[model samples]
Target: MTGLGWVGQVLTVEITGFAHGGLGVARHDGRVVFVRGALPDERVTARVVDDRKAAFCHAELVEVLTPSVHRIDPVCPAAAAGAGCCDLSFVTGSHGRELKSRALADQLRRIGGVDWEGVVEPIGSSDTDAPQVGWRTRVRLAVDADGRLGYHRHGSDEVIAQTDCAQPVAGLTDGLAGLGGLRPGTELVVSIDDAVGDAAPARQIVQIAAPSRGRGRQRRRPRTGPPRVIEGGPTTLRRVGERMWQVPVTGFWQAHRDAALVYSDVVTGWASTGAEVAVGWDLYGGVGVLAGALRDAGVAQVWTAEGDATATAVAVNSFADDSGVHPVTGSTETVVTGLPRPGVVVADPPRSGAGRAVVAAICAAGPDTVIHVGCDPAALARDLRLFAEHGYRVRDIRGFDAFPLTHHVEAIAVLNRDR
Candidate 1:
């Protein structure tokens, strides 16, 4: 059938495998169908949502004819109603992590030609019984026309107002009640300082962004003004081990409470190996978390590069006491060429992953060690292949189930240059 003919049509198919973006893989009539809300080894009936491509189409699960043993009742009502927050909430936490591991391994082997047989390790919490939920320290919510705060539907701009999402930390969503009067289409960036113990009380920070202004049907201009702070202070505290950082409420920070510490430790361990590392480069270094790790690991000089000026200012102020840590504000692709050559380079690029130009630049710099972090498995795999073209061999790779109850996973790969 043609692409347009498949739209709105329902078909039953057996899911043979999982895809990177939490979709189930199935074949029907010589075309691949990506079905949401379905799991591998299960038979599901799904409605075709988009069939723009002739080779494959997108679908939404309608009915599960054969549910997997790992499937369970969704923990959050919003998720059950198709809110985009907890895409994998229907599966057990262990099973979800297992699926993520398999997905990551598949990406590495297929796209990067690197064999990986590791599992995605879970980040634990004090709430042992409900560890998967209430772990998100940061959340971005959309305000609908009715002034309700919620998340957008999957692959859509329509907002689904939600008062109870399972992914946020405790009390992070408490401000949702008082947020009804905000302008329609405005965005809310909510953050919390989830430090444990009596010394540091949990504090919530809320920032509001104005609705994007544009002519009808034209592309909306980016929000130029900074988000106005509504609740709490302008900055919130986040700590990794003994070090503390005052991250701006509107600035970038790890969403999971324990993600900073976990990733920092991982980067430290990986960057510490190999020959004497005098100088290190931290690309896309937000607030200098991993750069601090490099410094702590005895790198004499560390240059942390971030594009956001506000984030770079925070990093500079946070590291003012130590001159060895230099925070520069510029695109990594541009700033990397002017900086002094380093023995090791650590890059934590955005979800799009570091492109070929950036990867080629890093390779041209001739760093002895390269530590790459990626949130998207497919993008990471592609970049790994690019690095391989530049003579970097993968040494160790680890996956972290940082965003629990969701399909998102964080992965870090350590690579060493071939001598």
Candidate 2:
């Protein structure tokens, strides 16, 4: 079919492979069709939902003629109903990890020009019988027209109201019912910090943000202010290893319960390659988590730069007892230029993956060791390719199934400058 004729057409195709973003790859009429709710080696009838591109199209699974053995009932009821919380929840945890591993390897080879033969390791418990639930400590929901809290539908702005989402830890969403007079189309961010020993009591915070107003059909108004805390205090306590940080509720933190600890441990191991390293840089550091890890590795001085001023203030206050740690508030690309020369650099940039300029800047600094962390596979691959161009060779790389039951994977790459 040609032009818009493929839109709304139904075709039965064999899902031969998996694609990024939790899609199955199929071909019909010499064009690639990305089908949702299908798995590899499965035969399914799908309806094309979008055909904007000439080379590829998007389709929704209508019926499964054959299913893979790895397919299972989704633990989340909302996910079964097309909610966006858990796109890969229909598959077993092992299968999910395998798919993520393959996707990462594909991106690395195709985009980064590096071959990968690594697996995406699971974070918590290895028991096969254990259900992957109650791992998310943070969740964000959108308000529908009737002022009900729900997640956005997959690939759409429509809200799927659900109270029993299986991803969040218990008591995280308990305050949703108590919230009164919520505005429609607003966003609700709920975060819970479970108490550890005598450190502090369990705390949950709920913050609401007004919907962005658009001047036209395509232009959205920039956010003028931060989200307002409605239920709890402005900040929540997060404990990674023995260190605890007071992070703003609206600030960035790992959603999985064990993600911070796992990433921190990896960073510490890779960053402690040399003894008596003088200075280290933590770019896009949120609340100085990795900076503390650097300190644990015996780095004499550490500079952490973040754009969010609120998070930076928290980092400043949290690291006050340690004079060796410094928090700078500015964009990573700009602040990196003014930082001191470093023996090591740890960059945990946002999903965009520290584009070309930041990578070039880091390369120019000539750090002996650089640890790059990325949440998106494609962006990470592109950034890795950039590092290759700068003469930084990848020494080691690891992938973590941080976001279980989802297609998202966290990867860390340790690179060293060639002599």
Candidate 3:
């Protein structure tokens, strides 16, 4: 299949195609396919970027012969113009909820190879389908040859620097565009909280990191640390109730304001299912955010652990201030394996998913209940299976539309020992 399907000429796609984030076709061979800047029921003209396989093609949108009713002005200009943010303006805002819900389901079946469909129910906003539009909180940008600030082209090394993002937290983007063109040999990172709202009190900011030239004899990579350069992102302290969390600008923090409250509420409510758990463990404790929640919820004797030093320090002080919550520092695998064995274990692991070590530890401990918080449904599904095979039973699985756009959804699963 090798032909423009019609070069530079527009084709009226019936708006019927998609298989996960990738494009798809029912059946066709020897044709160049183009998709992007497409809408339902609209005709579009595309430029072929690459043609391959029997029935697929890559394309760039040249024009829309007819736009779909669902199509609207993109909220992020970067979504339309920046390569890195290529999908920024994809579909209507409301479509975010819909697409993400499906994306989660699809990932489990297609990526994780789970045959069960609808094993998870998506919990969406009752008021709206999409999450907040802007103030992304953290952004990674590339520096141009002129040492100016900008973004990386969608698929190329090219730079498209900008001063403002539609999604930047308030006050943070100020002078951001101007900070480009550094003193030479350095990097830049920006962090903000949209929740603070404009004109509100300012929050804490650690410091930014400086970059180094790459592949040189003097160019040595910094040890794994916060994503930011200040030797790592500036130390950030987040207080949840009586617990204070020291997170780096580069470290993970819930993007939406009030989301932590929402998560904490859910975990506390779920924990009520059992009392006197054989053990109480918080995985991916990340400054013991959940552990703090456990303390507030009145759950005692939790072995809370985290990896980052700054985060762990925050954990120590946060829980130390309370005198009831306990904290440990190390990898989740090690923490889980060495635990004294409780009836309940709560974890919110990273996007890549949990590993065999954690799974084995869980199996070995054989807790009566397990609560898992995950961002990737596919990875979650895989880990769920591992837990199931080890004697834990998945009692319930539900999702939270955390990041409204960008094909991401978060989930929480409760597993029982059925004893």
Candidate 4:
């Protein structure tokens, strides 16, 4: 397939294709161009939008001359608007999940090289089923010159704004489109979803910051840190639960919506069930969100340890509203050392995975089972091998496509210590 570049050819052609990020491959400029809004077996008038040195150009579908058998008209308002979500333009709901499964399997093989020992199964949770309905209860939007609230353009500094979206949570459509009084030139951070409902089981939490702060920009600092609004500024939202959050922006929380339930379900299920006394040591625990979930599921005693003072404060408040979870605040490693040995140990470290000392510490703690939930597969694999060397053999492994449409997958491994 090398050197087959057709830069200017627009000939009628039919070919099989795949749906990856709203893109399907076609010969453009004598090379492959991943086209938007194009389906398999569809003839289209396309134009090259991006060209890579590797002969892969990004194409835009101008017209569909012939559509594919699998082609289905997307109902999402943002699908073809070309400015909202990055992919899933022509995908059916079921097909979207399947594509997610396939992508996860392929990534494990190609990236982590972990085999059949790996269980690629659908995680049962409130979030796994989120993609179907308007599960996105929150969003941050930018205001265009026309006072429209939408997302920013892909690479440009401009915001191509819109008033409504199809995938927003139930009341978010009205919330976003109804931001009534704003200074003419002022930008806004709009909040939506179920924050108003404290008793709704299906509640959601959504936030859209105004003056639309640029991505990669620091969540605007409080002159004295959040809990304190700046003299003239935006609301800061720090999420504590699905629909519960304290707005003060600089607060840290997991970025994805589907992450909490998936992480909680995997960790809770892996903690040996129906046991009277299963003690869990949650290392690198962020505000004890995971530990609280396990506690709700019947773990006898959960000793959650974390490093952040502010997050620990939030954790304390979170558990104070509940019961059974004890928050231990300190460095993740130092906190692990002071805890009593337990039957189960779960660690969800940041992107670098568990460090060398942390891995050794997990081994030192010597639980009957070590459940490692990590964001990076390579780093996770490294620690998994370390645990194997120290007698924590990986018996069952599972992965969750927490970050949909991206290369990120959350893999949790259950290791059984030698009896």
- Report the CA-based lDDT of candidate 2 relative to the real structure: 0.86
Candidate 3 residue lDDT tens string, 61-128: 66777776666666666655664553525555565555555656766566544443342222323545
> TM-score rank, highest first?
2, 1, 3, 4
Q: Write the per-residue lDDT of candidate 1 for residues 1-419, one digit (tens) a residue.
A: 45658899999999999988899999999999999999999999999998989899999999999999889999977787768888998998888888899989999999999999999998865333333888888888888898887887876788888768898878888758566467677788778875756765455545566445444335453665667677777788888887788887767888888888898898888777655788899999989999999987778899988998989999998888999899999999999999999999999998889999999999999999999999999999999999999999999999999888888899999999999
Tell me the whole-model lDDT of each prediction, alpha carbons only.
Answer: 0.86, 0.86, 0.61, 0.59
TM-score of model 4 vs. true structure? 0.67
Per-candidate RMSD, Å: 2.9, 2.5, 5.3, 6.2
Q: Give the TM-score of candidate 3.
A: 0.78
- Estimate the TM-score of every prediction: 0.93, 0.94, 0.78, 0.67
Q: What is residue 108's positional error in candidate 4, in angstroms?
A: 0.8
Question: Model 2 — TM-score against the truth?
Answer: 0.94
Pairs with backbone N, CA or C atoms under 3 Å apart (clashes), candidate 2:
none
Off by over 4 Å in 2: 1-4, 128-131, 175-179, 198-201, 211-228
Candidate 3 yields a Cα-based lDDT of: 0.61
